[model samples]
Target chain A: MTVGTKHTHLTYPDIDEAVDDDVRQHMEGMMEAEKGVLQAREQEMEECECKEGMFPNPTPGRRAFLLGAAAVAASTLPRGASASSGKAPAGAIEFDVPDDPTKVQGRLTNDDGGYGTRSQFESEARWRFPTKTKETSWTMTPLAESEGIITPSGLHFERHHGGIPTIDPKKHSLIVHGMCDNPKKYSMDDIRKFPSVSRQYFIECSGNGLTEFKAPFLKTVQGTHGLTSTSEWTGVMLSTILNEVGVQDGAAWILAEGADAAVMTRSVPLDKAWDDAMLIYAQNGEAMRPEQGYPLRVFLPGWEGNTHIKWLRRLEISDKPFMTREETSKYTDVVKDGKARQFSFTMEAKSVITFPSGEMKLPKPGFYEITGLAWSGRGKVRQVEVTTDGGKTWLIASLEGPIQSLCHTRFRIPWMWDGNPALIASRCIDETGYVQPTIAEINDVRGLNGHPKFASIYHLNGIMAWTIGADGTVTNAAHKV
Target chain B: MLIHWSKTVILAGSLVAFIAAAPASAQKFNFGTTPSAEEIAKIDIDAMPDGRGLPPGSGTPAMGKNIYANSCAACHGVNLEGVSAAGGAALVGGRGSIGTPKTKKTVESYWPYASTLFDYVRRAMPFDKPGSLSNDEIYAVSAYILNKGKIIGDKDVMNAKTLPKVDMPNKDGFIPDPRPDVFNYR
Candidate 1:
C-alpha cells in the first residue's frame, strides 16, 4: 500500500501493519524537522553587521515612537523576563523589537534543534477578562487580530471550571459502562487503534457573549466573541466504542464525566452520541494542549462547550439524565418569568465583524475590507450580510471557500468609508435558514427582567454593530438595532 | 390517481426495505476490553438525581461544621460568602433574588436538587484537594450548607435515600428550553 491509499476493508491486521507503519514513518519525519520552519536558505551566507548586533533596522522615526510605546507597555508587563531584553537576539535571528524589518529580509533555514514557537515579532496576546479569579475567569482570544478560520491551538479561548488538569496519558483510561452488554475500558492505545477520522469543528461556550445580554459591556471584539474557537479535531467516533460495547435497548442518556477536579458531568442524549459525538485526542494535527483536555475529550459539535467534557474519564449510559451539578446547578439558562431553561444544548447561529470593531481605530479610512467570522452549531453558515447603514441596507459578504459544517467561516466584503460617522454591522444566515437575531428582538422574546438583567444570556448570537466616527474611531453600537 | 399512487407507494416501499436491510450487513470492529466490577467501582463516582451511585455513608449537619471550617472556610468564607480572590462562589444567599437585577444566586436560592450539592462537594470542593473528602464528610458538608441556607433541618441526615428525597426550595425554577424561542426561526 502506498501513501494516501484508502483502506476499503480495514481489519485489525490491515491497520496494525500498513497503518501503523505509515503513522510511524509520518511521525518520525515530523519529529526530525519539528520546528515547522517553512523557508529555505543558502549553504552559507556572510554574517553581516546586522546579524552580529541586535538593533531594529532603523526606520526614520519608528525607533523613537516604539521606544515611547515600549516604555508604556513595560509597566503593564506581567512578572517575567521582559518581552524583549535589549540584547536578546529574537525574531528568527533578527533584533528583538515590537515591529522588526528583518522579518521581511527573509527567514533562516528550517533546521532548528526541536520544537517551535510563533515569531517573536507577532505580539498579539489574549486579553484576560477582569474577573476576581483567574481559574474561573476566561481569557478572550484576539479575534480582531486573527487572520484565519482556525485559531492557533495556543490562542484558543479557555474556560475551565476547576482549572486545567494535568493528566498522564499512561495512567488515563476511559471506562464505558452502564446499559451495555459488555462494559468496556479503553486505554489511549486501544482508542488510537480504532478506525480514526479527522474533522474540523467549532466549540462555542454557550456563555460566549453573556456580558452583552443587557447592554454593550466589553470594549473589544475579542471580549465579545472570543469564547468560540474552531479546530481540526482528530479522533475515533463515540459510536465506534458504543457499538463495540453493544448498547442496550432502553438507554436514553449517557453521562460523560471528566477527570478534572470538578469531575464535571453532562448528560448527552443517546441520539447525539450516535450522531457526531467524537472522543478526540488530537487537535490541529497534534496532541491537544492540557488546557484543551489533552489526552481525551468528547467533542459534541455544535453543542455548548460544557457538554464536550474535557479530560474525559467515564461515560455511563442510563435511561434517565444524571442531572449532575454542571447540568442542573450551573449551565442551565435562566430566562424571564423567573424560570431557567434546561437542556438548551445546541448553540444557534452567530456572526461578528472582527475588524473595524470596538477599540480599533482606522488610520484614515478610504476603502476598507469589512471582514469577520460566522458559524452555526446546526450546520454550515449559508450567507453573511454586511450592513454599513445599520439594518437599512445589507450586502451579502463573500464567504471564504471550503466552508464546513459547524466550523468558523471567514466572510469579507469591500466597503468605502465615506469619511463620516456610520453604523456598520454583520449577520449570518445559517444552513438551517436561521437568520441571526438582533439584541432587541432576542431580548423582547426572552423578556428582560431587571433582576440578573436579561432573562437568558447563555446563547447570545445576536448581530454585533459598530459605529465608525468621522475621525476613524470605531465603537460598539450594540444598542442600535 | 389510484394507479399512480400505488406505483409511487411501491417505489418508496422498496427504498425503505433496502435501507432496513443495510444495517444488518453493517460492520463492527468490536474494539476495547470488558471492565471488571472492581475496575468500575474504582472510578464510578458519578451521583445521579435518583441516588443510583451514592456510596454507603451518612452524615448530619452537626458533624459537617467542623469539616467545613477547617478545609472549606478559607475560600468559601466563614459565612459561605465566597472569597473572590480564591475563585470561590457565594454558596448561601440570594433567596427571592432570581428575577431581580441584583440576583445573587446561591445554593439556598437556586439549586433545584439536594443530590447535586452532595455530588458537587464530593467531587470538587475544598479547592486545594478535590475528590479527597470521604462520602460522609461530603454528606456532612452538604447537610451543613443546606441547613445553614435553612433548606434542611440541622438534624437532617444526608444519605443516599434521604438526600435524594430532600425537596429543594427552587425545585420548580427551571423550564425546558423551547428554543428557536428567539425570532431566528429556520
Candidate 2:
C-alpha cells in the first residue's frame, strides 16, 4: 500500500509504521495530536474487512479478528482510544487471532515470509530518555518487566552519539591503521572468514544511574539503572585482528572511531584491546541492530558503553591517549579533592531488587521474588547480598546459572513481605572483593567534595534501596537514606 | 615428473618459512587489504593533543564569526551561552566550577587541551551538520569558542601549531582515578 505522499504520515495502521510516524512528527517539532491517528483510522477502515464480519460469530478470518481486536481495545483503553489508535509497539505486527485458539489450526510454519514479529499484546520497549534531540539520545530498557539475564536483543539499551546509520555490510569496512605495520582494512565478509568466538558481555554506561546520585530523582528502576544490557556478542577477538594488523612498539592506546554522523571517537588502552575487546559483527546470534551499530561495532568488554564505540569503522593504534571530547570533558568524574578523575573505566559491582523496585505495587505481599540484575565490569559477580532492613543485615541471594564474566547475572531471593514497611536492597560483590557500597557510604567519600553534597554522575554502583510501604507499595528509599 | 618434484619441495619450504615468520609479521589468516591513501583521508580525522594529524589551514576569531553564526549559533548560542532547548553546551564561562555546587562543565572549566576543541569541531560539531565545516573554518570556530572562553586572544590565529600551544586553564585539573576508592567489603 502507498504511504502518505504529501505528509508522509502512516497510510498503513501497522505498529512499526505508526511508531515511525510518531518519531517523524516528533523530529518535525510537532506534538502528536489525534489528527494523524484520525487519518490513519479513516484509511484503516477502508482497508479493513470488518464490514464482512458480525459480532459473536462471523467468518473465521482476518475480518473477524479485527472486529474482536477492536472490541478488546475499546474495552481495555480509555474513552476515545480504539484499535485504530494503532499503538501496539514498534516491532509488533497485526496478527489474526481467533476467539478460540484450541478449535482452529495454527498458522503454518514459514507463513510470515520466513520471519515473525512479537505478540501485539506483549509490548515492552526501551523508553527513550527525553533528550532535546532524537539524534544524540539514549533509551532505557524496561528492566522491571525484564526476565532472565540475557536481555532480548530488541530491548537492549542504546546510547547513540549520532542517530543510527543504515550501513550495508558489503559497503562497510574497518580500517586498522596507525602505529600498525600492515595498516590493513577488513570488510565484513573478510572479517567473518576468520575463526570467531561468541561470548556474553554486558555494556553499562558509566552514567547509568546519573539521576539517582545525589537523591532519588526518577521513580522506576528502569529510570534509575536501565542503561546496561547483556547479549551474546559474536565476532573475532580484537587481538586476532590486532595480530593481523601487527601492532608496533610503544602502541599504548588505540582510537576507535564510528562511521555515524558524529564519527564518534574514543581512545582505549591497548591492554584492554589485547585483553577482551572484540570487533563484533553479530549480537545475540544475529547481525547487530542498526541502533546497536549495524554491520560492525567495537565491543570493549566491561568498559563504559561510550568507550565501546558503535558503528565502529576505524581502529587507529597510537602511543598515547588522544584526549577526545568524550574522554576529556564529558565522561570524567569530579572527585573529593576539587579535581576530576579521567579514564575511570571499570563499572564496579552493582545490584538492585527489581521485583520490589520503585513504583511496583506488591499485591497483598506474600511470597515475592526479590530479584534483579547484578553485574561487574571488573569481573564475575561472585556474590550478591540482599538486605530487607535498610542495610542492617544481609543475606546471600541465589544467582541463576551461566554467570558469565562481564555479563548480567540474575540474582533471586524469596521474600515473604509481611505487609509491613521494609527497605529492600541488594549489593553485589565481584571477584575483586569490591562490595557495592551504600548510597550514604558512596556519598561519604565521593559525594562530599568539601562543598555541599552533589555527587559525581558516573560509575554510581551504590546499593539502590526500595522501601516497601505498609500498604504494599514499593517506592525509592534513596532520598530517605 | 622431475620438475613437479622440485616445485613441490619449494612450496613446502615456503610454507615452513611462512609458519616461522607468523609471530614477527602480520600473516595470520592473511586477511584484509591495505586501504588506499584517499580512503584513509576520508575517515582519518582524529587529532592528537600534541598537534599530530592536524591540517595546514589557519583561521582567526574574525574569520570564524560568520561560520559560527551561519551554522553553529542556532544550537550553541550566539554568545556561546548554550541554547538549553537545543541541547547545546555552553563553551564560555564556568571557569572554577568543577567541585562546586554550580558545576557547569564548560570548555573553560573542564576540557584539558585546546587541541581537543579543534579536533572535536573539525570532526563532529554544529551538532546537526557534523564534518560540514572546513579545516580552516573549524580552526576559526575553535578560536572563537576559545577566545570567548578567555583561553585565547582576539588577534591570535588558530592553526595546528598555535592551537596545541594554547595552554588550557584546566590542564592540571584532571587526575588518574586511583579507585575502588572505597574499601569496605562484606
Candidate 3:
C-alpha cells in the first residue's frame, strides 16, 4: 500500500490494496472503474444507518419553525410555565427511557470501528452554483458553518473545468522540464521522498463574490464568500525542485498544465515559484481529495485559485507568459476602453459577516455575538470593522483564534440588538494596508471609461451588507454601499 | 531558540548554522529520473506565441472544412457561433466589441495570439474527445477558424511560421494588471 513499489500505469491496484478488503471485493464484483472504487470508499464513510422514524428530515426555515413554536407556547401555556405537564413532551422518546446516565447502555461497538459521523444538526455541506453542466461547475464551502481557519477537508470549496479527475498516484509523475539543466520526471513516491514542508495557507478564487457585483445577489454568506478555504499543504517547495533541476537564467514564467480532461494550464511567475510556491501532494493531514487534485497539485499562496493548477502534470519554464486561454479569454478582467486586465493574480483583502446573516433568524435578539471570517491574500488581516447600521458607523471587531498570513481569520464583535430593524456588514484591512472597498467604489474605478455595471465580475472583494427585519428575518441588502 | 547567545555570539552561531544548513540543503535530494527526449516529447504540447513548439505538420482551410464539420461544429457551431449547451464559446465575430457596452469576446476579436488556438485545440478540443486531433488536423482547424473569422485568406496554410505570423485582430486589447487600484491604501 506504500507509494513506492506500487502500480505505475494509472491503475488502481495500489488504491484497492489500501482500501478495506470487503469494499474492494464489492467494488471488484461490480467491475467499476478506479473512480468507482474511490466513490465507494466515500460511500462507506457515510454508512451511518438509522431507523426512518428516529430522524425525520427537519422542516426548512428555522425562523418560521421557532417563531411558530413561540406563538403556540404564548397562546396555550401560562406565562413562564413549562409546555410539558411533567411527562415526556411531544416528539420526545416514547420508548423505554433510561433515566440513570450510568445505567444507560449505548450502542454496542460494531464490526466497523473507529470511523466517525457528525451529529445530524452539525452537518457541514458545500453548496453548488447552479450551472448547466456539473463538469464546469463550482461548489462553495459553507464558511458560515466552519469553526476556525482550517476548513474541513470534506467541506472545502471546489472549482473544476472538466470535473474532478480520478488520478492514480502510482501512475502520476510530475515532469519538471523546459529551461532547466535536467528535465526529470518524479513519481509519486519519488516526490514524497524529497525534503517536504507543510504550511497553512488560504487559496481564494478571484471570483469569490462575483455574484454580488451590482447587488448582494446571493442570499447567504456561503454564496458571497465561500470560495476560500485554508489547508496545511505538505510538499516540496518549488524552489527545491527548480534548484534540483537547475533553473536556467532568463526563466521568468512557468507554464503549468494539469492531466484533467481540460488539460487546464496557466503561466505562473518564476519569482513566486522561488518564494513560496509548493508542489503539494498532501492537504490537511493526508493525500489530497480527488476534487482538490488527488495525486498532486501546485499551490501559490496569495494567488488566484485557478493559478494553483490541480492534477499538475507538467512544468515548462520560459522567459515570458504562455498567455493560455485561461489567462486571456477566461480569467482576464474586461474593464473600460474594451481593454481587459491580464495576469491580475492577487486577491485583495475581503470580509463578510456570517453569523445572523441572510436567511437566518435572530430568535430573541438581545446580546448576540456577531462574527464572520476575514482574510487577505496579500497578507494577514490587520483589522476588521463591523457596522450594525449599514456603513454609517463602524467599530473595530476583535479578531479571535490563530492569525496566519494568507489564512482566513475569524473575527467577532459583541452587538446589542435593540429588537428593531437594522443593517449589518463587515470589512477587512490587510497587512499590506489595503482596505476592502465597497461595490460602488470598485465600479467607480473600473468603470471610469464608462464600462457597464457588473462588467467585470472577477476580484469583487467589496463589502457585503445584510438587512435584518423586525420580524426576526435577515436578507441581503443589495446596492448597499 | 536564540535565548542564550549574546549579540556577537549569536551572530557567529547564526553564521555557523547557515553554513551547516547550506550544504545539507544544496546536497541533491535526487529522487527522480531524467526523462528521455522521446518521453519528454510525448506530453510537451505547449505552443508559445512565437511559434516555439509547433509540430511538424501543416494544413489549409480547405483541408479543415470536413474535419470541423465532423468533429467541432456540434459544439462550436458550423460557423463557429458557439453552442451554449455544449459549453463551446463563439469562436468568430465580436470585432470592435471591447470597451463598448455589448462586448462579445470571441476568438476573432478577443484572442491576442493565433498560436494559442493551435495550442488549445491540440491540447483540449472536440468538447468530448480532447487531445484526439492530429497535428495536421489542429493546423487545418486553426486555418479554417481563422479564415472564417476573416483574419486570414481562405486558401492560406497554417504551420509553425505562418501561424505565429497571423496577426490577431485584438492583439493590443490587453493591459497588465494594475493592482491596489482601489483607494484603500493601508
Residue-pair clashes per prediction, in order, are 5, 0, 3
Q: Encode model 3's per-residue lDDT on A1-481: one tens digit a residue.
A: 0000111122222222233332234334322332332243234223323211101111211222344345544553332222223222122211121233254443335412555443222334676765546787787887754676888888889999888988888988989899998889999999988779999898898878765665455555776778999889999899889888888999999999999988999999999999999999899998888999878999999899999999999999999999788998888888866788999999889888887665555654588788888988899899999999878999999997578898889999998888899999899999888899987888777762212333586888888888877755667785574
- Candidate 1 runs further than 4 Å off: A1-111, A450-455, B1-26
Worst 10 residues of 1 chain A by lDDT: A36-45
* lDDT (10s digit) by residue, model 2, range A272-314: 9998899888989888888888888888888899998888899
Interface RMSD of each: 9.1, 4.9, 8.1
Top candidate (DockQ): 2
Candidates sorted on lDDT, descending: 2, 3, 1
What is candidate 3's CAPRI-style docking category based on DockQ? acceptable
Worst 10 residues of 2 chain B by lDDT: B21-30
Q: DockQ score of candidate 2? A: 0.44
| lDDT on C-alpha atoms for all candidate structures | 0.75, 0.77, 0.76
- Chain B TM-score of candidate number 2: 0.84
Which candidate ranks first by TM-score, i.e. highest? 2
Q: Write the per-residue lDDT of candidate 3 for residues B1-186, one digit (tens) a residue.
A: 456547779789897787678774475767899998887899999898999998999999999999999999988888899776565677998798766765667899899999889988988787688889999999998999999999999989999889999989999988999977897776
* Per-residue lDDT of candidate 1, residues A1-481 (tens digit): 0001111111111112222222333223322221111010010111111111111111112332355345535554332223334421222222323233333333334534466655433434555554545555566676876777999888888878777888999889999999998798889988899879999999998878776776775555776788988899999999888888888999999999889877878999999999999999999999998989989999999999989999999999999988788777678876667788889899999999987786555656578888999999889999999999878999999999899999999999999988888899999999988999998888877766522433466888888999877766667678685
- Per-residue error for A90 in candidate 3, Å, reads 29
